[model samples]
Target: MLSSIKRFLIGRPLKSAELGEQKLNKTKALAILSSDALSSVAYGPEQILIVLITVSAAAFWYSIPIAIGVLLLLTALILSYRQIIFAYPHGGGAYVVSKENLGINPGLIAGGSLLVDYILTVAVSVSAGTDAITSAFPFLHDYTVVIAIVFVLFITTLNLRGVTESASVLAYPVYLFVVALFILIGVGVYNIVTGQVSPALHTPVGTPVIGISLFLLLKAFASGSSALTGVEAISNAIPNFKDPAPNNAAKTLVAMGTLLAILFSGIVVLAYYYGVQPIGEVTVVSQIAEQTFGRNFMYYFVQGTTALILILAANTGYSAFPLLAVNLAKDKFIPRMFTVRGDRLGYSNGIIILGFASILLILAFEGQTEQLIPLYAVGVFIPFTLSQSGMMVKWIREKPPGWGTKLFINTTGAVISLTVTLMFFLTKFGQVWSILIFLPLIILIFHRIHKHYEAVGDQLRLTTCEPSIPVAGNVIIVPVAGITHVVEFSLNYAKSLNPHQIIAVYVPFEREEEEIFEEKWKKWQPDVRLVTLHSPYRSIIQPLTRFIDTVVHKASESDYQVTVIIPQFIPKKGWHNILHNQSSLMIRAYLLYRRNVIVTTVPYHLKK
Candidate 1:
């Protein structure tokens, strides 16, 4: 039944050969991977205003320059990652590039940074999406964290099913969001050009504007860089693309870049010219939507799409984080469990972990996007610097065709990213200091994991051939609750093991029960010795464990090994097992650490 439920939820297991069939084409791939980058415009434009509005209302116009700076950096990143796609076509992204070109520690830093960034991506996107919804319907504001958690769970479930399934589920809403933004941009641009735009409405803001400073401009630029968080996701997941994976991934990167540049730049222009303010209750993009489409169906439609695409943008993390975890795990930098694929060929452990981490962040922050946004940018630029620097090293060392131009491009990106990293540190370090702490802890964890794997390898290593010791005898003990077909079946399995001694042991609470079981055993004549132990406290584990210890002590004089085979029955439904008190579990637990004694469970599955 559990298997059936799992099959229904995530579909039947796919063969290893079927993985290629699961690869995504460019269009679906874009929708699945690009959602995070594309959906940033929902909050990216406003993040600038969030910082700028602190100085003064007049200082809000500085969003234009801040945005243009972000755009220039964005263009350089797009070009840099395009080079990454071609250079490390097998989905290297930052961590792989840095590890290959830079060094081990630098690679670990990149991996740790990207992993944290993906977690924040889910948290910030879902929280912002919830904020968008609450803005539309104020009544839901109280349940914001609950709503965000539910949304994260929903995305997690869809992704566990498979990447193609998730892409199909997410593609429509993302495209709908894209279409809606274009509509907002077109309508707003038309109104501006034809002189039909109305005067800006004044809304009371809870947070007031303050004095401006150079630090304020730097803070705004740093804040504006949140828009670039998901830009590397596509490059990280290039292996998920179909035939000509690198070329297709490069094209998808171009498509994502084009859409991000147009929509973000357009929103920035509209917000500035239309005189939108960073009102507390509503968003900057929402304000633009209100002005462009007014309080009509289209306005609400745009808001609805914004909420969906923002929530589904978490899909980008689901796609990339698991893949990154797999990469790290392969390098022995993390637990190898993450490398195992689930029934649908997705990295289920990594996906589930991402969801839970996001949920924790949501709960901790109470689903407030503003509180989470400051923690967002630091994770992003660390990888950006490492990856671009790695590429710069690659171009200079490899000296491929056009290597000089490529080197220049990556060098420029690395410098800009490093500069941003420093500026963000100087301007917003207090708000984002947790990243510094988190990165070091992650590096330590990677070192510990690598050490453990090395130790395990040493233990498992073999140097020379050794002579095998012959077994003098095999002792099999089957612990039974009664003389029934289950015990009979267990003895048959023990017989297959060719044991010289087969002891069917039973511990009876009452004397009459022992007499009855012995009587049945005598009549059955099961070709195995039956030993009965009396228990005053109705304890099954203690007496059985003592008997096993005696058997082990007797066998210690020879080369014989002791085996304890427990007879168990599995109920058809999972809950049915709870109704029975399992002595087998107790016996196994007690003997788990016993030396040279092997414990095996022979399960008799019940038809019902």
Candidate 2:
């Protein structure tokens, strides 16, 4: 029944030959992998405004420059990752790149950082999406965490179904979001150019401006850089693309980068020109939507699509995290279970783990975007630094064609990424120190797993042994509670082995009971010897185990084999088994891990 349910939900398993059928074209790959970075236009501008406005209205003017800085950073990363795609076409994310170039310990750090970032991507994206819903309809404000968790589960199910299917399903929402934003940008820009102005709603720009400083500007820029979180996802999943996977992936990266730069810059421009400020409940994008197209269908359309794209943004993490986990597992840093593909050729275990982690973050923070935002950029930048630095090392060592230019570009990316990593650590230390704590623990776990795999390899290695000899004596011992059908079944099975000797042993709590059983067995004359042992303490497992040990020792001394056959009653119904004592289970448990000792079970099924 469970298999049937799994088949229905995730579909039947595809053959190995069907892998190409699951491969995505450039369009679908962009939709599946680019949603998270694109969705940042929804909240990325707002995060910047939230930080800058704390300083002053004058700082609001810096929004454009800060966004431009983020844009420049995005450009550098895109170029760096394009080189990464070509260099490691088998899908090289930060972990693989770092492991190959920077060594194993650094590689583990990159993997751990990416894992945390993926979880935060889901949590922050869902929380921000829920905020979009509550902004449109205030009634849902209380149920935000629950709604976010449901969205996580829903996306998880879609992904588990198949990558191509989920991408096709999610494409329209992304296009809608793009269309809606373009309309908002076009209308808002035209209004500003034609000298049209509308009264500010709720409050004006920065209300009471505070004193601005260099620290305040850096904080604002760091906040805006959240827009760059999902940029590496495309490079991480190059194998999922069609033939010429590297070229297709690189093209998609450029397209996604273009869209993000336009939407993010356009939104910041419109919000600034229209005097939009971060107000309670209402998002900057929503406020900009209202300004461009009033509270009409178009406004709701923009808001609805924004909420959708934000929620679907989790799909980017879903796509990348599983593949990253598979990479880590291949290196024995994580459990091998993550490397197993599901019926639909997706990494099912990684998808489910990502879902649960997101749910936990959402519940812990109560679906608050502000709280999640601080924890976001730290995880992202760690990998960015490692990936770019790794690429720098690769170019210097390989020195392939165009090596000089590539080396310079990657070095620049490394510097910028490392600078930003330290900046986030310094500015957001209070909110992000948990990640610092988690990295060491993850690396320790990786070492422990590596040690375990090495030990297993050593133990299971084959070695030459002497040839086998025939006609060795076999000794069989059966533990009997009473002369019942279960005992008879075990005795009959023992005789079939044609052993040199068979001993039926009974350990009894009382002398009177033992005598009665002996008399009955003698009358039956079953042609098997019966040995009675008395236990003063009435511990059935101990006496039975000692008897088997004595037999094994004597057999080993004579180059003979030993077998302990125990009989168990099988009930037709599960509940019926609880009515009987499980002595056979106890015997099996005791004999486990005993080298060269064989234990077998014979079952006698009882009629209901």
Candidate 3:
């Protein structure tokens, strides 16, 4: 029944041969990979205004220049990641690039930082999407966190179905959002040009609370840099593109960058002209829509598409996090389970884990977009710097065709990204200090995991000089609660092994029970030796294991193996099994890692 439900939700499993069909084309790929970057225009400008407006509404004018600075950084990243896409077509993004060129530690740092950013992307994007919904229908305001979590779960399910399926489902809304914003920008520009509405000339009524400084501008820039959070996703996901993966991925990256730049810049320009303020539940984009379309169909259309694209933005994280995790797993820096693809050829474990982590952040921050913004950009930029720096080193070492131009571009990107990272630390340290601690701790964890995998590999490695020898002899021990068909079945199975000896062992809490059991056992006349282990503490497993240990020690002289057969009764109903003691399970678990000790279970099925 559970399997049927799973099949229904996730669809029938795809064959390994169908994996090629799962790769996305350029059109669908842009929607899936660039939604996060494209959708940021909805709130990216607002974040800058949020920081700038603290000084006074007049200072909000600085948002345009700060946004341009962010744009320059975005341009650098897009070009740099294009180099990455072609250079490392297999696609590990910053982690692979940094590890190969920089070192192990830097690679781990890049991987860890990007992982955090991906999680934050899901949280922030969904929260902002929820905010959009509540903005349209304010009564849903109280359920913001609930709505955000529901969206996360929905996207997770979509991704679990497969990448191609998710892209197909998510593509429409992203395109709709782009078109709606473009319309809004066009209408606003026409209105300004034709004198339908004048440029915002009125200063805010409030007095300037604080004077503007270089620090203030830096703070705003850092906040707005969230626009660049998902730019590296395309490079990380080149493997997800169709044939000619590198070329297709690079083209998608360019398309994403172009759309992102136009949408982000247009929205900022319109907001400045319309005098949109980040003062209420209404977003800057929402305010611009209201001014241009005026609560009409186009207004709600923009709002609906904005809400959708923001929610779909999390699909970018879903797409990239698993790919990066698989890379880390291949390097043995994370669990091997992450490398295993599910029936859909998706990394189900990584996707599910990313969903849960994002849900946790949403809950922790109460699904407030601004509350999560401070924790957003730093994770992404650290990787940006490392990836760029790694590429710079690669160019200098390999000096491939056009290496100098590539080196210069990456060097500039590295410097800009590194500066942004520092700006985040300096300006928002009070809110984001935990990230400083988190990055190092995660790197330490990666090292520990790598070391553990190394130890496991060393132990499992085979050598040519090692001898292959079978066990000299076998002794079987069966633990019996009482004489029953279950015990008979276990004895028959043990006899089939034709071991050196077989013994039925029992431990009793009281003397009277032991005697009664012994008498019944003797009456049965099974012709097998019975070993009664007396337990003062009434612990069944301890006494039974000790007796087996004694047998094993005796058998060691003759090079005999000891096997413990456990008889289990299978209840007809799963719930009925809980009524019985699980001593068989406990015994098997305890003896699992013991050398030369084999544990087997013989089951007797019950009708009712």
Candidate 4:
């Protein structure tokens, strides 16, 4: 039943190693990866006014120039990352970048940043999409958190179901967003050029024109840079594409870049021509929609498309996180469980984890995408710097003299994006301090994980052949939890080991253990030996440890070895730590320290 439910939630998984380069076509991969950046057209302009609204309503006009500068930077970064595909076509993405030039720590920092960024991408994109919906229907306005959660769950369920299914579900809606924005902007532009354009349904907002300064201009540029948030998503997710991996990656990059540029510029122009003004906590698009279409079908249609597109953009993260987690797992930054595969052989566990984290984040932030927006961009830009930086290294290490043109292009992109990275690190430094807290925690997870891998790697590492120890009689001691079920299973396992002695060791740590265990195991038909070491302190682990040492000391003298049989009953459905506690851990630790003893486990898998 659990397997079936898992199947239903995650979908039929895809083959993990079966992802061939030529398998995924360029157009499909582009559509999937480009969703977030393309959907930025919906809210990138909105963010500009959101920031400046505190000072004056007139700051909305400045959104145009800010978006333009960001757009230019976006183009340069795209060209830079393009060089990345040409160089290291593996799924390395940002890690390839940082590792190549900046060293391993910086590579990990890039990894940490990108992982956080993908999570924020889901929260921000979905919340922003829903915000667009609230623009049209105020009835759904107060329920953004609920809506975002439901949306994340929905995507999670689909993603767990399978990648292709998730992509296919979101593909059309993303396409719809692109087409609608293109058509609306195209119509608006054509009307203006053909002299059929009229003033916006409302007057152009020029009143209270405040003098602009460089600080304000830099702020605006930073705000527009939000459009570049998902540019690195493609690089992370290129491994998921069909065959012709490099070609598909490059093609997807170009396609994403083109559509992103078009939708963004078009939205800016539409906002400007329509004189769309900003309302704090109100949507720029909705205000313009009401003004331009005034309850017409076109307004509703465009608004709906925009909202759906935003929600689907979360798919990009769904695709990338599982893939990135696989990389992290390989690096030992995450659990090998993340590297574990499902029926379809994909990293289903990682996908589900990513989905759950996104949902929690969406709810925690109250589904306010803009509130999470500042936290989002900084990490993504960091990876952008790393990826571009890595590509520069890739070029330099393998460069010929005639590669000047390529070097020049990639170098320029790295500098431009790295500069933006620094600005965001500073301009957003105070406001986005929360992410600083989160980044270290993630990095530490990576570190602990790396450290664990090193430790485990050392444990599993073999330098020479083990000294031949002649086989002799061994004691099969089963440590029961003093429960009815534990005793029954322990005896069965002890018999199976076929050891010299089959005994059930129950440490009477507590009075209850004495009473309950004495009454429980009083009648043993097969006469299984019950060893209860006294612990006046009522500590189970200490008594068990002392008992084990005594058994080994006696057994060694008798030309016999000890095989400690531990019966662990961990129900399929129970709080993990609460049940396992210190007993199981201490037992494992003690047994592992005694290499001569063969510690065996008898597990009772009960229903939830």
Distance from true location, Cα of 255 in model 4, Å:
1.3
TM-score-based ranking: 3, 2, 1, 4
On a 0 to 100 scale, what is the lDDT of residue 532 in model 3?
89
The C-alpha TM-scores of every prediction are: 0.89, 0.90, 0.96, 0.85
Q: What are the runs in model 3 whose C-alpha is more than 4 Å off?
A: 200-210, 464-470
lDDT (tens digit, per residue) of candidate 3 on 257-293: 9999988888877777677778678888888898898
Candidate 1's residue-wise lDDT over 1-608, tens digit each? 77898888788888888898879999999999999999999998898987777666666667777888988899899999998988888885999999999999999999999998899999999998998998889899899999999999889989999989899889999999999999999988898889776544222333334576777877788888888889999888987999899999999999999999999999988887787888877988888998787889999999999999999999999999999999999999999999998889888999999999999999988988887877777788999999999998888888999999888888888888998788888877787898878799999999999999998887666752545546789998889888677777888999998888898898999999989989999888557899999998988888888888888888877888898998988888888978998877878888888887889999988888
Can you tell me which runs of candidate 4 are displaced by over 4 Å? 9-22, 51-61, 194-210, 464-472, 479-542, 553-560, 566-597, 601-608
Residues 1-608, model 4: lDDT tens digits: 88788766655545556545224566667667888888887777766666666556555566666777877887887777676776667776887568668887788888888777788888998898888888788888878888888888887777665656666777788888777777677777776677555653323554455665677667666777787788877777766777667778987898888888887877776776676666645577666655556688888888998889888888888777777888888878888888776655456787778778888888787887767887887778778777766666766787866567777777777777777666766777775887778777888788988898998777665763445556678788778765567658768767776778876777775677677666667665246777776688767777776777888888888878888777777767656647556476578777787755777776777765
Pick the winner on TM-score between candidates 1 and 3: 3
Q: 497-566 in candidate 2: lDDT tens per residue?
A: 9999999989989999889889998887468899888888988888877788888888887878887888
Clashing pairs in 3: none
Query: What lDDT score belongs to each candidate, Candidate 1 first?
Result: 0.88, 0.87, 0.90, 0.74
After superposition, the stretches of candidate 2 with alpha carbons farther than 4 Å from their true spots are: 198-210, 463-487, 499-591, 599-608
The C-alpha RMSD of each candidate to the native structure, in angstroms, is: 3.9, 3.5, 2.2, 4.6
